[model samples]
Target: MRPPVEVSVLILSLSAPGVFITMNNIPALQEPLPILGMGMVVLGLVLLLLLLTVRNLKKVDPLFYVFAGFSFTCMVFLTNALEQDGFISGFMAFYLKMGEPHLRTAYAVMTSYWEGVVHLLLFLTIIHRMFRGKSYRSLGLLWAGSSSAIIVHIPGVVIGKYGSNIQPAFWRNVPFFLVPFWAASLLFSRPREMPVVTADKIIAEQKKGLLSRPVDLLLSLLLLGAMAFSVFRGFVVLDCPLDACFTYVYQYEPYLKDPVGFPRVMMLVYLFYALPLLTVFIYGLKTPGCSWMLDWTIFLAGAMAQTQWCHIGASLHSRTPFTYRVPADKWWPVITLNVLLAAVPALLALRCHNNPTYFLKPVPEGQTINEKKKN
Candidate 1:
């Protein structure tokens, strides 16, 4: 069986002793959950049919379906949770039912609330926006938040299913895994409209001390350093030798050999995160008055916020392999630091984007160019 989620070692978890890590545990139900799986199946089919009947079906983007599919999965899990029996229907019920063959970690249980309840609502909001042709600014948060909640959980299920003979109720996860990808094609087919700027909508909020003087400069420098560390971490993940990275990485940090799931995704995300984010921060500092800075910061904030959440969540998750667990000695420091990585960007984004005038170089009042007496 795949050992429970917890980062116990840097590269040694594969052979580390299994010890109880602090994860939320779930108890197994002696009997099947007190509900019918088939009923939900019928409801899903009916919802799909109803969606298909829309008059503008041709104009409907596939992202809608991705949203629908994930929402459906969320609903099914909600059913399991609400029944208070951890039961579900269709193929997913087998993997998701409250008991063994599942990791039964708190993260797994929380997924029910995140996917089944929160994601369900978020998808509906996104769909409402899509239909209304609203700006995607709000969508930045929705997409990242939902992605964080779900993406972090994926490696857990994958390792559980493949590492062990655990079924994972794979059928239940089909739409959750595939829908966003298919929808991405549709999303990128055209250029996205940027948020409209009202030139220098400076407000008292813009004068907030956080965005003034040395504070902004210090924060930018700090963010760059953090991103640099993130890049180094990614390198380690992509196979930087332990001897080369030992000084930086905890001795007990887990790195699976040919690691799959969370470790793999993390390495890739770090590479993506490292350089561009640093460049963004640099560009903002160098061109303090740049208009595009606000938009970039906002989007990056969403991306970082969720990424760190997923990273930390995966590390603490019960399904995490023992070999990969963060040793207890470094747990608080590591987890707390990652938490900071998420927070700094979010706060910066809020300060910069929420008030467009927050970072612009203010012109002196009553200033106009003096006319030169030239002949």
Candidate 2:
């Protein structure tokens, strides 16, 4: 008899391919897209022009601009929810089919229901802002949530184009990918780095150096560790060989190596965690008098915490196959690390909030504010 593992793999082999890759089930085919996609863009732009020309568009928040730009995003969400097929669901399905099957399934589920919910609420919020001419208090949460969703989706589309039957040609599927990012950029645009109070000034104010504070040192190091691990794990997701020390931690989960979970999650980790940590180190903590960087950091902590919970919860759930089950023995490390990922940011945010002078130190001498804004 074949080994039990081989039998299990063989059994899964029959059901695995094309979990969400059915051409016949295409949503656009079911309900034509020309009027929906490009037409909506034209209409949205027209309405946007009207809103800008007639109304004080400046009164609205930046995220409102994203919603206005992605005017038909509600329809995309609705189409996916109703028909279980649409541009987003279809394109992501095709893309994920090339790599891990679970990612397609996850993307489909997220786009279908989760997206339906988010897009609807996001639409309402935008309408509220436009009509009411006021922004919601939950601006930070809105930015973090919307940005994280698009952040995860990007790596899937990018990596899926490799080695799959999915045509690598642009233009064919470019709109679906570009639109999300364009919206995301609007939602999370950063301000120009403000000039920092000089170190002499900080000393004059009797504020301690960022690293001198015990709490700041600990939180900074904690985020540093998370960033390093995320990059190292990216190598694992990319199948870069690692020596024993690294694998013992990151390689614990078999399903993580599967395209669906680890790869998608890592994309967020790299974009959100790794890069932000470096930014915080350079300007947030090291420099003085930056904008309320701590406020954004706090919101990110909550957002990432929620994201990890979703990733971990979904992975262990029955939807994923036994072939990629997370080993129970390895559970603590995963959960603990993610919890830390979530908590450390909050702690840093708290630390900064409590002592603004420490976290918002002045930018380095000769650093131009407009140049920083361009970033």
CA-lDDT, candidates in order: 0.51, 0.49
How well is each residue in 1-375 modelled by candidate 1, as lDDT tens digits?
Answer: 432111111112121111111111212322233122333454466455436444444586556555654554555455444333334323333334432334344334444555555555666677666666765444534354345434545655566344454332334445555555444444444443433333334333244453465757777777887777677677776667768565445454563232445455555555674457657766665554555565556556655655565466656655566656676777887787788877877777676655555445344333311111110
Question: Per-candidate TM vs. native?
Answer: 0.58, 0.58
Candidate 2 residue-wise lDDT, 268-317, digit = tens? 56655556654565455655565556456645654565455545654565
* Model 2: lDDT of residue 64: 50
- Best by the lDDT measure: 1
Off by over 4 Å in 1: 1-69, 76-114, 124-136, 144-212, 242-244, 247-252, 255-260, 288-296, 321-323, 358-375
**Candidate 2 residue spans exceeding 4 A from truth:** 1-65, 68-104, 107-151, 161-206, 243-251, 260-276, 279-283, 292-310, 346-375
